[model samples]
Every structure is written in C-alpha cells, then in structure tokens.
Target: MSDRWQEMTVFVRVADSGNLSRAARELNLSQPSVSRIIGALEARLGTTLLLRTTRSISLTEAGSLYLERARYLLAEMEEAEQAARGIDSLHGVVRLAMPVLYGTRAVIPALATFLPRHPELRVEIVMSDARQNLIADGVDIAIRLGVGLLDDSAFGARKLAFVERLVVAAPAYLLAFSAPDNPADLARHSCIVQHGLFGRESWRFTHDQTVTSVDVQAKLWINSAPGVLAAAVAGLGIALATRVMAGEELRTGQLIQLLQPYRLDPAEVYAVFPAGPRPSAKVRAVVDHLEVALNTPS
Candidate 1:
C-alpha cells in the first residue's frame, strides 16, 4: 500500500512538472530513476499515462484522469496523517506564487516565523506580477492583490487583507516642482502608471466623506508594480504605490509619500488555491500564516 501511494505521488509530480528531469530534481531522484518508476507504474496499470518525447511530457487522457484521482487521494492521505499526528505530520514542498515586490518586501519577511515552526516542510516562492494558473504552474497557493477575483472560478480563495495605496514621489522630483497638495495636482504631474494592475491611468482618493477620482497623463505606463516604483525613485514621475511595495523606500526617504491624509481605497489581497478537494494541511497553514503576517502591524 505504501509503495502504491509512492507510485501515485511520483506520477503526480511528473505530470505536474511536465519534465521527468525537473521532477527528478524536485523529488531528489535521478532522471533515469524517475523514468523507470513511471514506466513500471504504467506497465502495472496496462496503459500509458504520459506521452513523452525529447522536448516535453504531456498527460494522455488516461493520465489526466489518473492525475486528478492521484491528487485527491494524496490530499486525503495527508489529511488522514494530520488527523493522526497533528501538525508534526505536515512535511513536503509547498509552492507559492506571488507578485514580485509585494511577496519579497511584505510577505516573505513574515514567513520567518512560520518556517521555523515547520522545519520539516520546504517553501518555494515563484515570483511574478503576471497572473499564473495554479494547477498548470504546479503552485500550491498564489497571492493576489487587486480589486476582485472576477474570472477565477477554478480556484478557492481566502481574503488576507486590504492594503492601502499611496501617491509618492522622490525628493528630487519634489525639489524640481512641489509635492501635490491634492488629488487634482497629480493630473499636472508626470505619473508613472502601472498599466497591468489599474489599467486606466487614474488615481482615486477620499476626503471628508467624499470620494475623488483623478485622471493621470503619463508618458510611461509600466506593467510591473516594482517597475513603477523604480521610476518614481529615479524622479521620472510620481507613482501610485502600495505601502507594502514602498515601505522600505519610504522609511529610507528614497521615496516620499505625497498627498497627505487622503488615500486610495485599499486593494484586496487573497490566497488562492485549486478548487477541488480540501487543501493539504501545509497549504492551509501557509495561507493562515500569510493572513497573520500581512494583517499584523508593521
């Protein structure tokens, strides 16, 4: 029974990774060893689970069905072990995909506490601002910050926190002109827009129970949050930045927070995981820890 489960686990890893050599490195087995295990498992089942060539590995129809069942069964086995041994049973690699700057500046530091408590587990962070398909990327959890998860029906999500954003500029830029005293002043300034996140070159602010929206005329539109902040630090233009992304820079005076008192509505942060079956204990623990880390006072 143990051998059967290990076979399923190996099959699942290979299917997820799409490369036997990559799966071999992840599983700490040689490439030939992983190939042999897959071959032996397929022979026992009397069907080919994968279509492999010199370039890539893909699941056959039988492999697709088997992959689903294998994931479900492995998740169940982990849960059963958890019920038997509590937190000590949580051992394995958990892959987390997150935005580049937010994950590095805000989320990663917080994991310092969570990791020591689970030394048996390993966490791998895949960082990108672009959205990732969790199952296709073999990610256990993805951290997202935005207005909403409108099209993500294939995943289950937990809200972590709402992060307030700020309008900021470098000391050098302010020296050239002057800091924006109000939202309307941003319209006259050169703004560094993050096109991917906000889409429209616009900024929103609130004051005295009233809301204000301003359109920005930006010569440069950056697709990355970090890229936008980098432009601001270089005095290229003013930027709308999240506190999470600019915390260190603001503290060091590389970037100065602008437009006092008024603030943009906080963006929503989420921990998204695949939709089927209860998440493994390690996944749940990591998500829970992120909620604490992000929401905790800095």
Candidate 2:
C-alpha cells in the first residue's frame, strides 16, 4: 500500500477499534509502527485526528470528518481495484454482522461450503445482537433478523426470508411438566425470557385474527439466543426462539414446539448494506449466497 493510503487505513482502524494496540494487532503491525503511521498522517494533514491517553482514544472533530471521507475514498479505491481486475473476480474481504446463534448455526455452515470455491475471499463475521454502524465499523454487509430494518437512510436492505418465533422446550421438560394449552396457561409454567430488542416481559401472540400480548414472568433472563436455547434444552423452561435458529433441534426431535394455536409475528431477515456505490463482487457474491442459503428449505 502507498504511504498515504496506508496511513488512512491505520487511522480508520484506530478510529474503529478505539485503541491503538488493538488496531495494531488487527493490522499485524507493532504498536510503535501503527502509532507512527497515525502521527505521520496527522503531521501531513496539519491537524490532530485523535485525542489519546493511557486508557482510551477519542476522535477529534477533524478526525470524525476525515474518518467519514477516508472511508469513502478507501471504498472507492477498493472498487477501482475490483473493477480493474474484472467484475467476476471475488478476491476481497467481506465484513459481515449477524446475531450470534444464526451466524453460528446458519451462516457459517453455508460459508463453509461457499468459501472453498473462492480461495482468495475472506469473510469476517461479527456476532452480536446489537445493531452495528456499518460505515463506522467497516462492515460490508449485515444479516439482520427482526420485524424490519431500522429506519436508517444510510443503508439499503434486501429481504432474505421470513422467520417466526416459536415457543419450544426439550422433550424431557415437556414430559415432566404438561405443556400449556393456551397463552394464559403459560403463567403457571416456567418461561425463559430473552431481554433485548424484542420485549422481555411481554410475549405477543396472534389467534383468530386477534392479537394478545401476554406478560410473562421468568426466573431466568437471557440476552443471547444460544444461551436461551441451551437453558431450555437443560430443561429449565419453555423458551421463545426463531424457527431458523432452532431448526436442527426441532427437526431432530430434541425440542418440541408448543402452543400451536397461538402464533407470534414473523420477522424478516435482511441483507443490509451501505447506501453508496454498487457492491463489489466479493460483497455481492456473499449476499447472493446467503440469500439462497437462508431462504432455501433445509
């Protein structure tokens, strides 16, 4: 990489990671080398980009403005390279964000198969339940599962599939405690509640065109879907989960789906990307693969 472009890359990584050492580790360079790159970039620009201390680093006003433009320039450069190589060349890194369980169980398996065909491509998966800032984080794509995409004009979304939340428990748990016939009967049984974007205390269900929100009490409150599934499998309680997430368990008869009469709202899975230039071949290839992998029947 050229000196100026290399400096911009280091500056962007530092800004994203918020720590010089961490960014240096990611860039596979020594701390002093990374620090010097940033120092040189600031000197060349005649402006301070970061306010740093022993504990943390924060962006200066100029840093914030420069970071935005730097990202655009870097993206354009990458696109130029890809265009010069030919549109069919898939030889770049694709940073993807997804929820923990779905990314592990669904996305990774698909990638395991898709990646071998293109040895030059690399996928970095960020597993988190919280929404990520794509541009700021340097993420190329995000596989999101929810009611819909957040109202952000900066992102363009393509619907992948519709996934429904199902109340399920292990067969052992169901055999020990009689399953609830109706939503209200859930009050007398143990319920595992997940506390995040979907409300924890209130579980919404629809029946006969009438929607009902049941206020559920729980001894166990979990934030991650995998943890909740684990707790349910250990016979702790009935947990609410997305069908896509619990597909294997449900198919193998490890977990029994319950309360079929009542249904929760189906959430749409989306491949969200930055609203800028057209996606490079690497990004488009992975997005297309994920769309087919996620939507196709198992």
Choose the strongest candidate by lDDT: 1
lDDT (Cα, tens digit) per residue for candidate 1, span 1-298: 4768878988988887788887888889998988888988999999999999999889999999998889898988888888887885577889998888888888899999988888889999999887776765778788888765445776778889999888889999999978888899888888887765655676778999889999988878888888988999999988888888898899999999888789788788988886353678889999888898888997
Question: What lDDT would each prediction earn against the true structure?
Answer: 0.84, 0.82
Kindly report which residue stretches of model 1 are placed more than 4 angstroms away from their true locations once superposed.
Answer: 132-137, 149-151, 181-184, 198-200, 206-213, 274-277
Error of 2 at 65 (Å): 1.5
Please write out the lDDT profile of model 2 over residues 1-298, one tens digit for every residue: 9999999999988897788887887789999999999999999999999999999899999999998888788878987888897755678678888889888878888887688888788888889877677655667788877664456666667777788889999988988999988888788788898666453667789999999888776878888788888998889998888887888889999888999989998877788876343555678888888888887776
Question: Candidate 2: global Cα-lDDT?
Answer: 0.82
What's the count of clashing pairs in each model shown?
A: 0, 0
Task: For model 1, state the Cα shift of residue 282 in Å.
Answer: 1.1
